[model samples]
Target: MIRTLPLLLAVLASPALAQGLTDLDEVDRQVSAFVGQPTPPVDRRLRLARCTAPLALDWYGNGRQAVQVRCPVPAGWTLYVAMPAAAAAAAAPPLVQRGDSVTIQVGGDGWAVSQPGEALEAGAAGAWIKVRGLVPKAPVLRGRVLRPGLVGVDLP
Candidate 1:
């Protein structure tokens, strides 16, 4: 039975490492309050390795000090975060955390990129694009990935 321990460990880590963030109920509440919208359930996957670029959210001012951003795969499921190559140049890479931090929640308006574009890579699964911040606001305590994906923001 001792030998089985290793196998069990691998299986557990696989989901949390690859699958992406999951079931962030507390984080959802915080985000809804922050955005002043009814928080909807959201669970999506982004193959971070494929993400040539990354997610960047800069926080300016007081309240919840949004230091850096990360999207570490909490479960094993080929986890990744991405943005258009050009977007990467425009914004910093998204932060990935080793452990779970429900503080970060992404919303539809939280980001702004050149244009909502996507590529399948060589033979990837989901639609993909480079992005700026999830919610480029300082007091923005949380964020969430909106269903149907990206929306454009007028560049200043």
Candidate 2:
């Protein structure tokens, strides 16, 4: 029989991968509300979807570059957007547990919740929807998904 050590080890040690690290999955879902997947880009334009989660509940890394920005909408083959909660604790300062609403910005300035199977466009990228309102700042001194997607991001 073939050595299954490597495969077994990977399986046993494998951590839960958040497919929709961004809000792409949620985008897909919300988009479905307005339009379906694989629809014309125009139809997918300007959709707004929101998510309110307790900081203690869910949070995940948005994978930042410089100012901990670039918190994109979920985009994955499986698992929808992994809330920043999963990544909150991993961040320098964990997100507030009270409540945070992450509104995914879609279709170039059109803010909406992301749906499953949808795509994240370069224009759709943003940071903390509730704050900052900056574009994606990456290669950060260090950080991960912190808050909602901002509208405009200024980096030094």
Candidate 3:
């Protein structure tokens, strides 16, 4: 029994080490409150890597209908939680106008880049829009509108 003690500890710790797990019901409640909308039920059979800390949920690709739940610790994985497909297809109107100065942010791994850009057209939170950077000759980049002046980009 003594010889196997270390092995037992390792086994118990493996799930948390490999990835973090979150309470689906709790997550749904928090997400719903944040968006002011009901979230789709997560399949109970789906297993997620456990997180050591609380999960941070936010709009992932466009910040419109999809929400991303991320582990706060290093090497923790990010899960993309989507809103109902029906609601996504019927999204809302543009939240911003053309020529509007907006904030742009793209994140990957554990780092994010934040900059300012001008909107090339009107778009809603999930709608894609062309954003012109401040640097000279910088090509217009496409990003999703997050809010009034905020946009979120999916990083590779």
Q: Against the hidden reference, what TM-scores do the models get? A: 0.20, 0.15, 0.45
Model 3 root mean square deviation, Cα atoms:
12.1
- Write candidate 1's Cα lDDT for 1-156 as tens digits: 999999888977875445543334433454444433443433444223322223332322121222223333343222122333333322332232222222222334566333222321111112122333423432211222222332222232
The local lDDT score (0 to 100) that residue 86 gets in candidate 1 is 35
* TM-score-sorted candidate list, best first: 3, 1, 2
lDDT of each: 0.32, 0.29, 0.73
Candidate 3 local Cα displacement, residue 70, angstroms: 0.7
Those runs of model 3 whose alpha carbons end farther than 4 Å from true positions after fitting are: 1-21, 85-93, 97-156
lDDT of 3 by residue, 76-143 (tens): 87766687754553445578899988888898788989988888888876777788877788787788
Top candidate when judged by TM-score against the true structure: 3
- lDDT score, candidate 2, position 110: 42
